[model samples]
Target: MLWPDPAQRDRLVEIRDNLLARIAEAEREGWLGEVEGLQMSLAGAEEKLTQLDRRQSNRSVVDLGIPAPATRVVGAVRNKSVNSSAAHTPVSLP
Candidate 1:
């Protein structure tokens, strides 16, 4: 499962805790089917958390060198001039 939002980690922890409690209750009540399903869900949650840990640990920063300020500013001005001139040009539809 892709946890895009950072808050989802907390939510996942809550879900895991709830599942544990449900599993315990199921076991006490002798609900074999409920116990089996909840156990599977708990396993999946644990696996997702493990995957998240591995992903976090493996993260590394890559440096793509920045362009010079003069080059960027010149290019932006040139593009704006071109765009503005095109917009204001009178079109003669024959």
Candidate 2:
């Protein structure tokens, strides 16, 4: 999980709080589209905050300390014949 710096996190939270307050006022003003846009913005900010919180937590992996998931082949390579002498060759698209 990616974490933001303290100053950045504080700024984001401040912005989110301000947005929440504005959302209340917007509700009174009946700005439906504005409310919708602000809600999306708030959700994004909240998501980032959640990710930051996760980064701060001390989590233990249950999968035996595996850093990543296993890779599975989906399809075979299109070009199997390798030409070492033409490594830097570039093709022009029509």
Give all candidate RMSDs, comma-separated.
7.9, 14.6
lDDT of 1 by residue, 10-83 (tens): 87788899999999999999999999999999999888777777778888998989966773444333435557
Query: What tens-digit string does per-residue lDDT give for candidate 2 at 23-80?
Result: 9988999999989999999998898888777777856666666578779989886764
The Cα error of candidate 2 at residue 92, in Å, is 53
- Which candidate number would show the highest TM-score if scored against the true structure? 1
For each candidate, give its TM-score against the true structure: 0.62, 0.56
In every candidate, how many clashes are there? Answer: 0, 0
Q: What is each predicted model's overall lDDT from 0 to 1? A: 0.83, 0.83
